[model samples]
Target: MPVFNQYYYEPLETKDVLRLVALDPATDERDPLSCTIFQCRRSAQRQEYSAISNTWDEQTPSQTLEIRCDDDISYVRITANVDALLRDFRAREKPCYLWVDAICLDQTNGEEKSQQIPLMGRIYGEAKDVRIWLGPDDRVTAKVFTLLRLLSQVLDVQPQWHMAERVVFHLNEVFCRKDGVVGLKSLLNFFSRSWFSRRWVVQEAMLAREAIVHCGRYSIALLSISLAATRFLSLDVASYPVNMAASLREPTTKRGILELLWYFHEAECRDPKDRIAALLGLVPNEKRFPLDYTAHWTELYRQVASLAFGLNDRAINFQLLRVSAPCPIQEMPSIRRGSLTGQSLGNGPYLSFLTYETQTPTSGILPHLNGGNIRFSPLTEASHGSIGIPQSAGNGVTESPT
Candidate 1:
């Protein structure tokens, strides 16, 4: 019946990730082995595919075109359709990674679409480059070009620089309940919770350090509070041994480095506008901190527990997460009671993120856990003097839910 809310160029899901993505391979591969976002070329050019006929009944070309806000497509005009968009991508032979929604996601396969939405980060995250398709308006595409160029300027690099290493390639923001204040904060809150989420904080910090040297500090307490929370509520020492120990002590090692990341996110993203600046490489003019965002969206989160189960077909409804604020910008996306449609990414991601952005590891980077100092030793000798878990899983720990 109705067109659902969709991201223009979202990534593929872990399970539906029909291909393995990588940079130019060693072999003579014409196309890398990864999912693509494709569409009908001719149908796009003509601007109409007779849905009622169920055939390629095309329409004569007209000067003006209509672009539907939602899938409703009820008489909105001024741009191209999905087909024309893909044609452009093919023509451009875009040097960097490109992710077109139609070609990337299986629209005909409704079963998979639902599972793919929440993993939006993986789709774009896994991409080395991204291309957005602005409908038929020359003005629209031109603005998109300008936006990309400006984004690049902020990200300023030499011409020889590779944007593929970083950048999500945003094309448009038309679908917001209102693309102004509501849109800005909705986007801010969305990226903030995710870009440096609690579970993968340690891995994210480690990745940041490895990629760019040191990353950032915080404004409101993020990591320290996270460690405290996880430590107090941790149920399994066997599965979360590193977290259990790190929660009790001050964070120093990579094992519990996540605590530090939460701090960094809060400091950088405290203001809704500042948060975007941090992501877009816009200089942080915040009074409390001054850290230029050095790296791109580094997705290092892993919920081992999610791997312990299968995906729910219901994660596609991330739209329900969008709240239509008072048609404004200064505030964040608030949870509107009875506003959205359903649940999102279904409270699990380790498997989901991997599903979309999965590139088989070729680097073989060593795991950072150090056994004696940060690693777990047999509890007997170490616990001789003070409080200890009585050998049989009684020390407030249980088998990993994972």
Candidate 2:
């Protein structure tokens, strides 16, 4: 293993520079779990390991836990959430190699963190499995599982639950009754879990080759929950139905990095910039903006907008901004801030334009010519009917409109 030094560790010869935790196979479950760090090259050599994705709670650091090693007892502090996850992992019958960011990374060393943070995508992507810890199981979790299972059966008939009228009929008949209200409430609470609202977990979940979700003693495949959530939300029931369209609701399926950043803006992070950094690897065009830990937050935001506009400059039009409220940041340009505001990036009014039943059509409007697509040629003071002038050309001095 390479020793940590200065602002950067010496670059390894290979792409694999990960730290794995080796658990003790000894007795005394009550004692703090013993762990040792090991490093290896992942791309050159294949190794089986599971990566744990979780939030570091505030209370856990202050509360010290005791660990007994070789007849010596010492107290160490860890986040409550991580302490629980480690305890649960240690209780398993077979010992396994795991990579947990909170323990594996030297949090105190800013230099080490700067080097390791960018590799987060590779770390989770290389893992054989990514275990998502959503705290513990409770009544809400139990009910959520039950509801999702029922939704799966309904969705089996049609992947698009909204199109399956028969399933909609069945759901109303079978689960929307007086007693089922309790289950509906549970579904709402289930989606409200802090795990779904996290920015870091978005990348962690997206990059995993395979993943599982653990809640207390109960465990389920990540795919199962995602599929079930998608199906349940797809059922567009009129009454007593889950509002899948809620801005903060987590999508039941995978989303790109930009979408996740926009959708989960409410997610909590110790550093505001992590809101952008955490999703770097998961973006579809991640290569466009390489991860740079030293970049300013404003610069990062500009980089994202610049790349997006580069792909389609038509995105710079003001029609996209018309529908959205003014951006909260007065310092940021409206064009850049409105990039994620659910606006069309093409040279036309939004597709929703036609859907507005109450909107009145203005007279003299060209069939397809709206303010969005009408390009005006530059006109000099001497030009009479270049482009800014009306179709009635009152002068013979037209220079081929060049």
Candidate 3:
């Protein structure tokens, strides 16, 4: 066993590499939940485990505190939302293994926190399933669950019914009635919940092979949520629809880091450092940036921007120019930083620019040319370069190599 900085950790072979909790809600609602940290070796042979994706309860002051669990001496610091999530997913018939971030990782130790951030991709991707906790359910939550169920049914049988037109009609019918206003409001509330906007959950849910959203006593498939989001994108709303669409869209195709940051930057997280760390795992291996908790936020933004420029592809690097937000740090430029206010919450900057094909630039001329040739002159005499230069307008031009 060894320690890095203040964080104490053992080698994978020697220590229990995988830490989980076995949660059992007490029979009496008045009684507190029974939670014990179960340590196990991360080997080829392992038991089924589920990872919990959630938002920390930061707004509620009293919700953030150390509480006593069934485990002995040390009181674990957890939020009220986490406690509720644990109790909701408690298994009565058998023990369930869950990898919850707040408890599993050593929050007090910065080094350990750094180590765990990278492994998050694997943690969620390898889990039997990721359970997304969207806080407690109310009247709104119940309607949302019902809406998803109905939407799922419609989407499933959509092909046979028509070219998704029938599905669209039903969607409008469901959300446009007298009580539909309240239902739509409730549905909006469901999507606007902190869980959907969480940075960690964005990556966790995206990487998961399978996932489900747990709302109090009710639960629904992640697919249903995504389908419902797509349906809502058809509606003309102020901002929620666009935010919901971008938030729920699966990151199946490889995309630049800028897109990921802009899409979920509004999401909640305790650490400003996590703005980068939480989403780093979802980026492609080649484009992936380093996870350094020691660096300042401005430095981190600069590093990411510099990496984008080094790629040398205009299509990718040009996105840096598309940034529409005001920079928070005076040291960093607006192009390198995005606003956290959800100001540009539509189909992402990159997607907006890359939507269609553009004519290649020969001499920086375009569609108005009708059909013309362009040529580049060789280096000037002062540059000590000898080359042949050709110029043509209606036809192609040929140039000799230096």
TM-score for each predicted model, relative to the true structure: 0.22, 0.64, 0.69
Poorly placed runs, candidate 3 (over 4 Å) = 1-16, 41-43, 59-73, 155-179, 238-249, 313-316, 319-402
- Identify the runs in model 1 with alpha carbons over 4 angstroms from their true place: 1-16, 19-80, 92-99, 137-402
Candidate 1 achieves a global lDDT of 0.26
Report the lDDT tens digits of candidate 3 across residue range 96-213.
Answer: 6889887777666666665567778888888999998877778556656777677656544333436245444554565665434565566666777776666677778788889988
Task: Using TM-score, rank the candidates from best to worst.
Answer: 3, 2, 1
Flag the better candidate by TM-score, 2 or 3.
Answer: 3
Name the weakest run of 10 consecutive residues (lDDT summed) in model 3: 383-392
Shift of residue 324 alpha carbon in model 2, Å: 15
lDDT-better candidate, 2 vs 3: 3
Note the residue pairs that clash in candidate 3: none
Model 1: per-residue Cα lDDT over 73-119, one tens digit each: 32211123433432333322323223333334444544454444333
lDDT (Cα atoms) of all candidates against the true structure: 0.26, 0.53, 0.57
